[model samples]
Target: MSSPLTLAPATGGQRPRRLLVVLGGALIVATYLFLVTVQPAEIAGGMGSVASLVTLFGFLGGGALLVAGILPMLSTSSLVVMPLGIALNIAIGQIAGSLGMQIYLDAIGTVLVAVLAGPAAGAATGALSNAIWGLFNPFALPFAAGAALIGLLAGLAARYGAFRRVYLAPVAGLVVGAIGGLVAAPVAVFMFGAAGTFGTNAIIAVFRSMGDKLLVAATKQGLLSDSLDKIVVFVVVALIVYALPPRAVRQFPFARTHRVLGGRTGALPAPSPVKAAHGGGSGVA
Candidate 1:
């Protein structure tokens, strides 16, 4: 596997250095796109709107920075595992939908990236997961920021000893779920105009029927729906880590967080299944 840490971001060969330079250039362009766009960015090319240019620039620029931010910490193993994370977010996410479950169960890949790598890697994974998912379903683009939040928070919680004890796992889940819900509410409002996304929109519509304002109803749905989904996501991640053999766990980026390595073995965990390989996809711009 490729251990990027050994390559040294600042020192390594010219190739690695060039990679950072290119990523940096993309970031610069992304900024201009964001600020200079003539209109608000929209889906489906924005039909010649400057927002379309922003979306393109922003996607490439922001994505490059997000991934490159984790380059130094990524092992070849971590890199291999990244695509798998995106695959899980897309595939299993549908299973939950197919079953008509209230929870999303979509962040499986996001959580995986976090657990194996550090929060940065996990953040990259989460953001990319949504972007990839968007490729097939443009409606998914607005939620990239939300997914990124899920991954970052989950990874940070794990980093800080959240997974060290069995009891703490669920607590972490609730926290992540609440935050994910809050973050997603605005995105839903932006895309669907307070009707919310499909799965949770039903709930949002109910809230609206009850006389809630557009943003309020959407936020309420987010709190309820996202909370349930992310709680499930976090808890499952914990469980997966708990069940993993030390060797399997060790190869991941955040292996040090495992209670097995941290001198505890009795912590409760939530969920995940590591297949180690899968195809990839993007969400929206």
Candidate 2:
């Protein structure tokens, strides 16, 4: 894939970005009011706050910014990877919170896309995944920015060769998780009031029982859960990369960049030469 700095094109190659920029500016004013005035009077889980309502509007603004990244990163290859990424997110995401665990397996696919492609593609995978999540449950709308951040950071980590060594994967994940936690904290506090489906919410409840501020409790919970989730995700992706055949893996944009072709490039064995020949050397062919 091209450098993340290599923007493909603006929406309509230009016009939409201009419009979004204007919309985003307006949303910023709303967000300020929400955080400054609205959040203070909130009772946990109560649905009454013009400021918080404005923050929800900010989620749309955040989504627009996230989507804006996709246009420049969008390509046929990214489109190809995106469906699989979303599927991975949906499928593994379901595996989460079973038996009351805090982990979310959702971002495996998003990180996979980021490593194979770049931040823009990864960002698309994340944004689209949450957009789909909103179809199943509207509560996911606020966390879209957090998901996008995860994908973006994973792509940036891969671009810098974090996947080259097995050990470095979690380090990358940690970074992604830390930033993701910060992004998600505000969403959970102002939008959802720290209520959630997993055991992480139990942790929030624990903090709340201790009289912790809602924002502080939510931030702590997000940091613990999101970081742990992403650490597992990065490590899992590393193992998957190790197990994949080089030829099969090479179709991705970051294949060469990720060193998936050799130890110098994190390469692994492919099908035998004869096997490839008999298969007409056509990987997807």
lDDT per residue for candidate 2 within 67-88, as digits (tens), equals 7745554667778888899888
Candidate 1 steric clashes:
27
Q: What's the lDDT for all of these models?
A: 0.65, 0.74
Name the top TM-score candidate: 2
**TM-scores for candidates 1 onward, in order:** 0.69, 0.76
The TM-score of predicted model 1 comes to 0.69
Model 2, runs deviating above 4 Å: 1-48, 95-102, 258-285
Cα deviation of 124 in candidate 2 (Å)?
1.2
Global lDDT of model 2: 0.74
In angstroms, the error of model 2 at 38 is 9.6
Candidate 2 residue pairs in backbone clash: 259-265, 259-266, 260-267, 261-267, 262-267
